[model samples]
Target: MPVQFIKDPNQVGDAINESNTKPVVIHYWNPLMGEESPFLSLFHDADENLGPNVSLYVVDSGFINPPHDPQELPLTALYVDGKEKQSVPFNVDQVRDLIFSAV
Candidate 1:
């Protein structure tokens, strides 16, 4: 399946819990901005490299009209597996690797 755009935190939690067998990539964003933001682009690129088994959950950051686009501002990527979580600066190659590894 492709990346899923989820707007609610409760839904995100449910989805994550339901998909414990699969790796989940939650693409958080400001709803008002739609997919025009840079984060979406990065997520899209990363999604292209992932296999069907990997799932995505788009969590809305609750910023309807963000002061600045994530693309314009620096962003980071987070990985969560069980209780372990790690975050790092967003990068093309790194994202690619993450997706590939998940698959």
Candidate 2:
């Protein structure tokens, strides 16, 4: 799967609901970080590496519709069967390990 851009995180029910069928990994990014944002590339790599059992959602805090937490930018949420199983730390290897472990 490709990196899915979450345009409106405030209205993320549909996205979260989609996770019910497969695991969803959410990456909240800070727009100010821009192209240099490390996670942007990391997510791309992860999306390519992750198998069909999983999907990745890249939600830019700048484009968040409303009702979402801005403080959560730069965080990662790993969900399975529509429920968040873990809040991953900011580390490439750690994130990868967590995903593999969950699936």
- Candidate-wise lDDT, in order: 0.52, 0.68
For model 2, the local distance difference test gives 0.68
lDDT of 2 by residue, 9-87 (tens): 5645676677789887777677786743477677677666775767777776554323345665566777777777777
Please list all clashing residue pairs in model 1, or write none if there are none. Answer: none
> What's the TM-score of every candidate structure?
0.58, 0.75
The best candidate in terms of TM-score: 2
Error of 2 at 81 (Å): 2.0
lDDT of 1: 0.52
17 Cα displacement, candidate 2 (Å): 1.0
Error of 1 at 89 (Å): 3.3
